[model samples]
Target: MKVDENNGTLAEARGLSGKKIKISKKGATPPPSVENKMSVGLIYVNEYYSGWKELCFRVLQSKFDSPERSFAPDQEIIEALKNCSIGQEMNLKQVQKLCMPFIRFKKDEAREVGTQALDLKLPFSEMDVLRENLELIRRQLGLEHVEVLSAFEVLSACDETAHAKAGENVKTAESESAVPW
Candidate 1:
């Protein structure tokens, strides 16, 4: 394919083998075997962390007016997220935190984690809601005696969460409430 020098389109003048870079507005044609769909772990390689989030945030903010400053660039952020899951294993919490830059979860339901750690499907909008209401949930649950429910047995006990049912406390909250003032 011929690229015009006037338009800043890169042309492969030589028989390219290694370290040939192409920059063109009208993209180069892919090889016959190459599928049109994007690969699962496409990444933009650079020496540094590529200015981190702040640079991108400022760039995006400049593109939008003040009213749209808080608005997240959903498409751009999702594409960036694809790069994060590359060549690494991540739990649901890690994935959730990763996508938090773009969104938050809103509901109390446990995260439906993927069987494989890397194949996370954390969505931004849902995460945004979760982030906003996390404090409220912690307060509602009264996390004074916070317990980690790591196993099925422990989580199942939540269904019958009372000393009366477990035969632990002789005077249960129910019994205390039943007493007249």
Candidate 2:
């Protein structure tokens, strides 16, 4: 599979000689012979916290597209989540305050929104409600952890490793040069 840098579209190379082929976007139907010969699999690259946040928004929007419970998340709210920070913890009350306006709740037993059930008799705090909704969202998205290392952090780690290896190479070179043939 080859990725188009300009449009970020993935396309399968047609021949063994590396010829570019335009794969149809309409259902992306592969050639019969290639389909029979190749097994397709999805590979995620450069995925980080921002990508997860976007996926979460998409899942929530699709699951709760009703007029009563609109899932239109704003950039500010998503940015405030800071899901990329490894140890950053968001205040439950603060997240609840930010999310309450966008989410709708009903007191009736028959009504439901997203994964929230309105059948419980006990009153729940805004934080509790938000927590439940978030948990449901996480489950639906199949995410085990919300926190992820940012691209910058990953690059920094790679740089550190590279530098350490370069230092070792330099030491080896110096020792070899000092030794008599």
Candidate 3:
């Protein structure tokens, strides 16, 4: 199975079926930002694509060029996003329906109605849907958000990375400015 980009849900994996994922740099695009390196890497951790790392090393080579220069037709970007795990397509409608209870948590957990989701029992329909097939969802898309704790972990990691980078840039600028003739 695969996810359709048009719909953002799973579908038949087409050419990716049966055969293992074979990533090629023939049309790879470079990573757009430093953060995307980690984002796409997480998606690739589970699959083995040919020349995947080499392609990443190549795309990162673009950063070596002066800001005025351009290195594109980024093989890493194309291959990373085009791999089998992304799926043939995705059905936003279906995902929306499935994630309703969690999304509702966004608003209710905000104003905190009736002690938030902690106080209330999920409706039978919601519980039934969430209780079943989580393993399947993880196997298919790796999107098992069963615990609020895990989401916090992901956020904390991102926050730490962003803050560290910001501090580095600030320190570099300050040091350069402090240099005087």
Query: Which candidate wins on lDDT?
Result: 2
In model 3, which regions exceed 4 Å deviation? 1-25, 28-124, 143-181
Please give each candidate's TM-score.
Answer: 0.17, 0.19, 0.18
Candidate 2 has a TM-score of 0.19
| Order of models, best lDDT first | 2, 3, 1
lDDT of 3 by residue, 1-181 (tens): 1224312322332222212333447865443344322211011010111132222333334322334333333343343334422212324343334333443433244233322222223323332342353454345542323211112223234446433433434444334332221
What is the per-residue lDDT of model 2 for residues 1-181, given as tens digits with 9 covering 90 to 100? 1113311322222232123234577957455455244332111122222332333333344444454644445443344444423114446454445343433322122134333432222233433333434443334333343221222233344546433433434454335432321
Clashes per candidate (backbone, < 3 Å): 12, 0, 21
lDDT of every model, 2 decimals:
0.31, 0.35, 0.31
lDDT, candidate 2, at 134: 46
Worst 10 residues of 3 by lDDT: 40-49
Which ranking of candidates, highest TM-score first? 2, 3, 1
Q: Model 1 over residues 41-103: C-alpha lDDT tens digits?
A: 111111111222332333333333333223345555444444453214445455445444434
RMSD of model 3, in Å?
23.1
True-structure RMSD, every candidate: 26.3, 19.5, 23.1
The local distance difference test score of model 1 is 0.31
The CA-based lDDT of model 3 is what? 0.31
Summing lDDT over every window of 10 consecutive residues in candidate 2, give the lowest-scoring window.
40-49
